[model samples]
Target: MICPFCGAAMEKGCIKGQHEMAWLPDDKRDALFTDAHLQEGAVLLASSSIFKGSVVDAWCCRVCEKLVVEY
Candidate 1:
């Protein structure tokens, strides 16, 4: 995929490290539903599930150093 931010070519790759997302409350989780935005002050619901890390297929733009993940 071509990076919309920089118009640079993207290469398919996998992230090298473990990536995690917090389990947030409904209101906080809704905030992230819009687009690729940052999550702040989010809490993880550890009592519910133990596994929180994930891996995904992604394309990276080396120029901007941004990653686009494909679920």
Candidate 2:
């Protein structure tokens, strides 16, 4: 996808390292989701039974650091 902010192309691939997110007390370890106001947004896609587990990928813009996800 194209980055709307910087007008640069986005790189398509799975995130290299383990990416963790949380909605509880803000800490250095977890990504704060209070701004999103959604609980359980960040989940283990592989073990999740709610949604059909499938190939998941993430894309990021090299210029603006905007990220997009595909599953």
Top of the candidates by lDDT = 1
Per-model lDDT: 0.60, 0.52
Score every model by TM-score: 0.47, 0.43
RMSD value for candidate 2: 7.1
Stretches > 4 Å off in candidate 2: 16-44, 48-55
- Candidate with maximal TM-score: 1
Tell me the lDDT of candidate 1.
0.60
Clashes of each: 0, 0
Residue range with the least summed lDDT across 10 consecutive positions in model 1: 43-52
- Give one digit per residue, the lDDT tens place, for model 1 in 1-71: 89988999999986432345344556667674532124565543222224634444679999999987664
Model 1 deviation from native, Cα RMSD in Å: 8.5
| Model 2 whole-model lDDT (C-alpha atoms) | 0.52
- Candidate 2 lDDT, tens digit per residue, 4-55? 7788998888643233322243433254444222444433432222344334
